[model samples]
Target: MELLLLEGVTRTIELPDAPPLTILSGVDLAVDAGDRISIVGRSGSGKSTLLNLLGLLDSPSSGRLVFDGQDVASLSSGQRDRLRGRDVGFIFQQFNLLEGRTALENVMTPLLYASGRQFWRRREIASAMLDRVGLSHRLTAMPHKLSGGEQQRVAIARSLVREPRVILADEPTGALDVETGGTVMQLLDEVARSSGAALVTITHDLAIAELASRHFRLDHGVLTPVSVHAAEGLIAVSGPAAGPATDAGEAS
Candidate 1:
């Protein structure tokens, strides 16, 4: 069951008196249920742009984006918003929680957009999700009161509260210490697997990237499959071996 697919997707921004800046060019990817994919790239390599496309936050200038076998471009703005809200989850590096909200309140925020019983039972659902992430005791804690790791856990709880089909994590552990980051990542993987959601993580750390079963490197808007030599702690371009890279779009 492919959850999302991108083929020859390209994004460009026009500038006055200068050539258009191509942020992403001919990018292709397919995400299936419960699949874990990690994309690594240097700063300013268009990783964020790609994430936006995958999350339906922005549209590509050219090419196709399919979600659950339906072309994204064919969806109206409201339809797109509904689909994104219902099927997609996002975890960011900054733990974007509201300033005055408690952990439980923050987690329940998304449910406000949901319908019927879900919205009515949002508190219970959010509480359980927080428990799953070991933040049950921090339910009433404000973002300022929780530690960095605790705040990230709250973010994770919020992301999973809706039981989305796909999870988009951007630099999820970028703000934590190495040990804490490792712990958070483990918790994230466990929760996503238990929920049966496909996970797509974008990061600059090779070690973090290696956590996924499939790995790709994005360079200059091009994606290539890569193999990780765990023992040597090195990564090498592995060519088109398996996974989404087999159908990766070429740069235009």
Candidate 2:
């Protein structure tokens, strides 16, 4: 089933010193449950703008976004907020954790706002989620106390705590080393796949994007699919340096 849908979407923005810019132009997309989609492009290629629109953090200037059979534009601001709170999970590049809060507290933050349960119950679930992310021991540690990889893991836990139907990750591995980034991306893929949620990863890394089941490249406000099969064949014939997941193979 199609869990999310966007049709004829267009978005425009104005800068103080520049003319109005069109970020997204007539974009159309449909994502089903368990779809691992990667949107790859350089900075200012409208990849993040598309992610924001998909996550309902920003409204489209024109077009329709139908999520789970409901027209998001038709909903009131409050209703849209509630929908975002319950149905969408976001993992930001910066981690976006409160400095003073412990890892467990940060994970529990979304659930607390989402669930009407008391503090103790929220803590229990939050701890479980942290354990799931392999961060149980660091539960009481503050955001600053954890390493970069650990902080990102906590962010993943927080996003998954609410068991959202869709997980939107914006440059999630941009801040980590290659090995750590791969590990984190693997964990994210596992969790989202296991939970039967569609995962949308917005990234500039072709290797990371290759790990996704579906890949699309955005250029000049247009999206084009990259055939992994063809890329894989080319890599096989080109030898070791031209591996399937290499930046060159992925960038096309």
Candidate 3:
């Protein structure tokens, strides 16, 4: 049931008259169907770079990356685009909803590229997904009128409507209050579980990251699994990011 995997992956960029910059180095990750993984990292820690590779929007400079048993390196740009559009869903911190589109219409956007039944039933499917996220009454509400939490709910419904194999949420609750964020995370976890899709959440918030069954920390372009211990008003992590898998401790 492994949906996406990375082994010794590295991402580097070239600069004119300067040494090559490496964003990620020897990063290893395995994502399976229904898996819940949280990756915590600060800004400029290469979390975004890793997410792009995971979503098939970018390829690694080196190493093996496989999606559903196919080597991503062998696929053409067109093939990669089609696969990402069909199987990968993204939820952003800003919600990224269409400003002029209604909740239902925003949710239906992904299906616009689909064929046959999905394309024809786009409205139906999107509406149902909104209902699933407890936004049935606000289906026609414009993004400008919705609260931050409500807007994020709409984004969640939109991301899940396609039943993607993998969902990438980049700082999904960054803009909401703690209470609203907790509620949204609960809803997201429930829906993703019901749909059997892998959930990969990238955030700097330890409270939010702890919600996942498995946890990892990414620092200076290196990733490692960690065990989280929540104390009174504080969180303590005990694991070091190492190059090899044997050096990391997976909590789950």
Identify the candidate with maximal lDDT.
Answer: 1
CA-lDDT, candidates in order = 0.88, 0.84, 0.88
Candidate 2 structure quality by residue, lDDT tens digits, 52-159: 899998999999999999999899999989899888999988999999899988998987676466345888889998999899899999988899999999999999
Error of 2 at 68 (Å): 0.5
Angstrom error at residue 82, model 1? 0.8
Output the lDDT of residue 179, model 1. Answer: 93
Q: Residue by residue across 1-252, what tens digits does model 1's lDDT show?
A: 578999999999999999999989899888999999998877888999999999999999999999999999999999999999999999999999998999999999999999998899999999999999998888999999999999999999888889999999999999999899999999999999998999999987667878999987788888777865444555677755544332122210
The candidate maximizing TM-score is 1
| TM-scores, all models, native as reference | 0.93, 0.88, 0.92
Clashing pairs in 2: none
Q: How many backbone clashes does candidate 1 have?
A: 0
The collision pairs in model 3 are none
lDDT of 3 by residue, 1-252 (tens): 479999999999999999999999999999999999999766788999999999998999999999999999999999999999889999999999999999889999999998889899999999999999999999899999999999999999988988899999999999999899989999999999999999999886767887888987787899878654433222335456334232222211
lDDT of 3 at 191: 96
Off by over 4 Å in 3: 232-252
* RMSD vs true structure, all candidates: 4.3, 4.8, 4.1
